[model samples]
Every structure is written in structure tokens, then in C-alpha cells.
Target: MNERVTPEPQRRRRRPTKQGIVLSQQLIIDTALRLVGQQGAGALTVRRLGISLGADPSAVYRYFRSTDDLLLAIADELIGRAQQGWQPTGDWRADLRAIGLRIHANYQAHPQAAMLAAHRTTGRTHEIAAVEAILGILRTAGFPGPEAVRIYHAFVDQSLGFAALDAAALALPAAARTADLQVWQASYARLDAATHPHITATAHLLATDMRRSGYPYALDLLLDAAEARLRAAG
Candidate 1:
């Protein structure tokens, strides 16, 4: 006769959760980036992000010292993606142009993040690294110390300024966008009718390609100048 043997219940091991307090910071930043992409930076707030993430509002504070800290993180993320796999090409102008275009395109991809990062410099690690890289490249090109600094400042200003302007334009209401277009169109139409040689004579050609050669053309022109300067010095 076998005695009834009742096996004791085995204790279940707790499966690891992908999301928890450990992920809270990354989650908040990711959610913030999404909201920023859709709505624009103005709509991004700690409280709002917390609500969206179902986390405590102050939980962000644990990772970021302040809202500015969070914004810098967002900037690093936005700008950092373009910098993935980026390496020095030794040709200063070419490298610089590549960097400028990459940075600009990255901002354009995320207009809200662009708008936020454009104005706020939290001195985040990536931001500093970008600056240092530019300076190093300029030095490699044999730019004088002062000249390198000047050109670096101008280069950064151009990239960030244009990105901010573009992001702001994209954020405008449809009516505002239309109005902006129409105003420029009307100005060109009026210019076309002017009798002055400088004003009306070239207006047809000038007004036709308002955005045709756009920012890339301008960037190319700038690169050409920088290249010329480098060649002259060499």
C-alpha cells in the first residue's frame, strides 16, 4: 500500500520585467521625444510627459537634474543619430559640409527637437564633442587659432539658426504657412512689374526658383569659399 504522496507546490520564479523604475528615465525621454516630434517642444512638459508615461512627474528628476537637463538629453539624441558612424575624412571642407548637412537633416527630421535644441545649449557631452571635433578638423586644415574659432562659431550658428527657423516655420498653422507663401509670391509678382532694371529685370528668374536651389545650394557655396580659403593658405 503506497501512502498518498502530495508534492509540495513549487515556488514560481518572478520573470523579469523589461519596464520598471530602471527604465523610467529612458521611457520618459522616449515619450518626450515622441510628443515633441508630433506637437512641438512648446507642448513638452515634465508633468505632461509623466502623465503620458504613467510615471510620477518628478521621476524625471531622478535622471535629469532639471528640465534643461532633459532638453539637452533630447538634443544629444536628435543630433547624435546623425553622428552615428561619423568619422573624420581629413578634407576639412568636405567633412564640415557632411556634418552641416547631417546636422540640418537630423533637425529637419525632428522639428520639435530641433526647435528645442537650437536655442538651448546645456553643454551635454555630445554637444561638446561636436564642437571639439569641428575645432580639431579646422586645426587639421591649418586654420589659425582665431580663424578656426570664428569659423566654428559661424558654422554652428548657421546650422542651429537655420534648423530653428525651419522648425518654427513647420510648426506654424496652415493658414500662417499659406500666408507666408502668398506674401512672398505677391512680393515677387510686384517685383516683376517694377520698371527698375535691378528690381524687375531679374525678378522673373530670381522669383521662379525661390526654393529650387534652397539651403543645400547655400551650403555648397559656403563650402566652396572655405575650401578656397584653405587652398589659398596652403
Candidate 2:
């Protein structure tokens, strides 16, 4: 008779980090957002995240293959936040306006993260959901398939482009931001009428309007055009 063969033991799972905190994908993303907000996007390295989470730097690799993967996840998270609690109002124009405003506000809320992520294509869950929702709205509005796609493309790019611009301004140093905001009043308002007739004429209005975001007006113009297109299609 032969002796019974012994079975090999399975490998043990990795335990919690030194701080006794369990790591999850959501947690990592939240921590990264916080770090970026507190410092800047450059502060979101593996080592920095490890320190923040009190885990091994390599632990982040277990969840994300690389920092770029993590950044994509962060970008997707922003989309997810923007879509949170949002329900389509059945009026296509109203729904589109709400969606665009939500995206812009969320990005503005997280300026540093927005600066890094506004232009990224995550192709992840949240981003895909947003695309599906917008496309559905356009198609439901009686837009043809190709037309719906074109409108969706323009709407998304316009929202992201303005968000990035606004975020960049928000991310500047406090003093610099103040100076930039004051330029219209201090410099443009003082321009000689002869040398800059148009600017000088509009200086007061420019001082007021330039301080506010042009996104809302631009968004309305786009929607107005789409409305006209629908009417013309009829």
C-alpha cells in the first residue's frame, strides 16, 4: 500500500493594511480625490496614495494596473457623481440642460481633478452610462440616428471644454486668480478709447460679464440651435 498523498495548501489572501483599514476601489478613488483637492493632481502618485491610505504602495497596483488606470477610474467617478440623483424630466431640452449643468458644476466643484480628467475618455461605467442617457434623450426628441450622434458629440465636448476652462481658472493660486479676475476692471477698463474703441466702449459691460462664466449662455445657444433644427426638420 502506498502512503496517502498530502494536498497542497492554498495561498493566503492579503490582509488589511497596517492601519487596519480595508481598501476598496471606491475608497482609493475617494482618497485620490481628496489628495488632489488638498494638494494638486501631481500629488496622486502610488507612493503618495499609499501614505494617505496607510497601505503598501504596491497595494494600489492590486486594484489598478497603473496610475493611468487609477486616473481613468477617477475620471469615471466624476461622471458618476454628476449623474447621481439625476432623473430625466421627459422634456428633452430640459433634460439636456440639467445634464450639462450637472456635469459642469461637478467638475467645477473638483477643480484639480477636473483639470486632470475633463479631457479624458474613460470608456468606463459612468462615462458609458452618460453617453447612453444623452443619446437616448436626443433620439427621443425625434432626431435621426446620425443627427443624434452629432448632437451628442457636440454637447459632451462643449460641456467638457467649458468645465476644463473654468476648472483651470479655479485651480490658480488665490492671488493670481484675484489678479486675473480684476484684469477687466483694472486694465481693460483703463484702455484708451482711441486705441481700443470697441473694448473701451464695452469696458463696463465686459468688467461685469467677464467675471461670470459664459458656459450658461453658450449652452443655451446650442440648445436653441438644436430646437431650431428640430422645428426645421418637421
Candidate 3:
């Protein structure tokens, strides 16, 4: 009689979300990025994230302590995306140039996220990796430790500063952005030459130039200075 006893059935694990999508830190970050990109940073509340994710808000909290934590993660994720597939070519100036441009371009690609998170200090993986790579380039280029740090500080600040500035413009409502872009042409270009001779003289140039991002030219200037410093150090 004992040999005929039945065995118990095994229970299946519960799925993390109603949509049956598996939860992960990367998936959370990706969803958050998309939300911010589409609806602006103000729309990135935990409840909204949960709705977008088809999960309980508690699930998101399990991965991040708070919204700020998630924002830092998003910022770090942008840094990671910027550096993805990048490798040093051993030409320090060229490498730094490439890294700076890559970071700027990536941030511009997600203007809302850039405007929201560009100024944050994540102390996360991508941020740490970026610092390491930049410092390595400067140090290998013959910069002393302190000089290398100083240069890295300036380099990162310049890149992020321009990113935030450009992103602010990009994040504006389409009509507003168009209005701002036309300021140089519509306002400055019409100024009377008598009282605004200098502005009038260069208004045409400003109309075109101001519409373009100054990041590339500024980045080259920084590289040129770094190259000069390296030469002078020798």
C-alpha cells in the first residue's frame, strides 16, 4: 500500500510582470530612457515607469532605491552607450577627440535625457570607465599626474556643458526651438546698422553659425591646447 503513494506536484515560479516580460536592470533602464525620450523627464515617475513596464512599481523599487537612483543609472547608461565600440588608436589627441565627439553625439541623440542627467555624478561603471580612459590617454601623452587630472576635468566639463546647452535647445517644443533658432536671422539681422554696427556686420555669419553646435570647434580647440601643452612639457 505504501508503494502506491502519490508524489506532490511542483509549483511554477511567478512571472515578475503582468506582460510576462522578465525584469532586469538593463530592461528597466531602457524603458526609463524611452519614457524620458518620448514624454520628457517630468514624466518619469515610478508609477508611470511601472505602467510603461507592465509591472508593479515595487518591482522597480527592488532594482532602484528611488527615482534619483534610476536617473543616475540612466545617465551612466548614456555614458556607457557613448563609449560602446570605442577603442584607443594610440594617437592620444585623436583618441580624446573621438571620445569627446562620441559622448556629445550620444547625448544629443537623447536630448531630454541629456538635459536631465548630463550634470549628474553617477560614480557608476560607465563614468568610472570614461575617467580611466581619458586619464590614460593624457598620462600616456606625457602629461604629469596633476596636469593630466586638470586636463581631464576640463575635458569632461567642456563636453557635458555643451551637451546640456545643446540639449536644452533640442528639448524645446518644436515651435519654440524654431523661434530661438531664427532669432539671429529675424532679430539680429534686422537691427539698424547705425547703433548695432558690429552685430549687423556679423549677423549673417551668426545666423548660420549659431544654428550649428559649437561643440566640434570647441573640442578641436581643446585638443589643440592639449597638444601644445604636451609639446611644451617636452
Candidate 4:
């Protein structure tokens, strides 16, 4: 019966004029980080992050062109933190190993993120800082500029490569990972006597010492060799 042009339903009135804090780029990155920390890197997407942040999904696009950009940012941040954690105590070999271990530990701290960033090149400010720091350490250790840069390149390749591999290993299915362990175990268990008497004689020690302990030792040895070469040149 009705002249029911039912008074046009009142438009929803905006609740108030209080200044609302809009999410900024830093906040988005921070939120994305928390999401990665909780759900792993694979779970991070612009839409999911936006959902988590209570924002329009397209908003995240303005901050990151895509997920890879977001990941690279995170990698730079994590690597920067790792660089900050290591205190170089005068010995270049020790300091370099400290850098390597810190990188390994940082990736281990966030396995998924590290995996995504494996071999990623950000050219970020922190990366430049890290290179500068390495060069400084090498120069302090008496490596001439060219030699320092060479060693710096090698060091960075191994540090990030190994860290990425370690992260991937962590992510591997348990059975596959266990199979890898089995291969290592098999190698450790059997050392031929005639061809490798030294290895056979100290198989246990060799296996235990060479596995993870040796990366640092190897790094130190290489640096010592570099030092010897430098001394010879001088």
C-alpha cells in the first residue's frame, strides 16, 4: 500500500572526523615481515598481507611491485642485522668466519625467507655497507685493495651460497633430508685403507672435524694463505 518510496535508505554516515593513521610503506613491510615470520615466506602474498593488515589488497601493490621485491627488502634487512651482530675482534680470519656464521645463523633464524632470498641480489644500502666492512677488514689484515676485493667476493659467494643451501636443506621433506644424512653417514662409515690411509686411520676424527667445523677452519686457512702471499710480495 504504499507510497513506499521508503525514504531512500539513509546513506551510511562516516562515523567521525578523528585523524586515522594510514598505513605507510614501512608499516606494510613490517606487517609483511611478521607474516613471513609466522607463516613462512611461501605464504606471503600481497593479497594475504593486505588481508592481514585490514587494508585493500591493491594498496600493497603501491609499496611492492610484486612478492619478489618484498622478499628482497626482507633479505637486505636480515643480512644487515647479521652484519651488525658480528663484532670483528682484530683477527681478520676470525672476523670473516664470524661474518659467515652470522649469515648462516640469520638464515637459520628465518628459513623460508632465506630460501627465497638465496642468491638474490638486492644492491641495497646494507649490501654496500657489508662490502665496505669486508674491504676494511681485509685491508686491516694487510690485504692490498685488489686482493681484498677478490677475497671479499669469494667470501660473500660462499657465505650466502652456503646459508641458502642450509635453508633449503631445512625445508626439504623429512624423508629426503634423512636420505641426505644417510649419504653422509655412509661416507663417514667407509674409508678405503690403501688409497687413503690417513683418512682411514682417523676416520672418526676426520668425519667429525671436517663436516661443519671445517668451514671456519677452511676460511681461516685460506686467509692465512692470503696473508702468506701478501708477506711474500712485501
User: Which one is best on TM-score?
Assistant: 2
Clashing pairs in 4: none
Off by over 4 Å in 4: 1-26, 34-41, 186-214
Choose the strongest candidate by lDDT.
2
Scored against the true structure, residue 150 in model 3 reaches a CA lDDT of 95
Model 1: CA > 4 A from native: 1-24, 195-199, 204-208
lDDT of 4 by residue, 1-234 (tens): 111111223322223212333655566667777787678765688767767767666655555666777777887887787887567799887787788778878877777778777588888887878878888999988888888888888888877777777777776777997777665457855868888788678777665553453355556676677778878978
Ordered from best to worst TM-score, the candidate numbers read 2, 3, 1, 4
Per-residue alpha-carbon lDDT of candidate 1 for residues 46-127, written as tens digits (9 for 90 to 100): 7877666666555555566667767778887776777878988888888999998888888888877887788777576778
TM-score of candidate 3 on Cα atoms, chains taken together: 0.92
Query: How many backbone clashes can be found in candidate 3?
Result: 0
Better of 1 and 4 by lDDT: 1
TM-score of each: 0.80, 0.93, 0.92, 0.73
Off by over 4 Å in 3: 1-16
lDDT sort, best first: 2, 3, 1, 4
Alpha carbon lDDT of residue 176, candidate 3?
A: 100
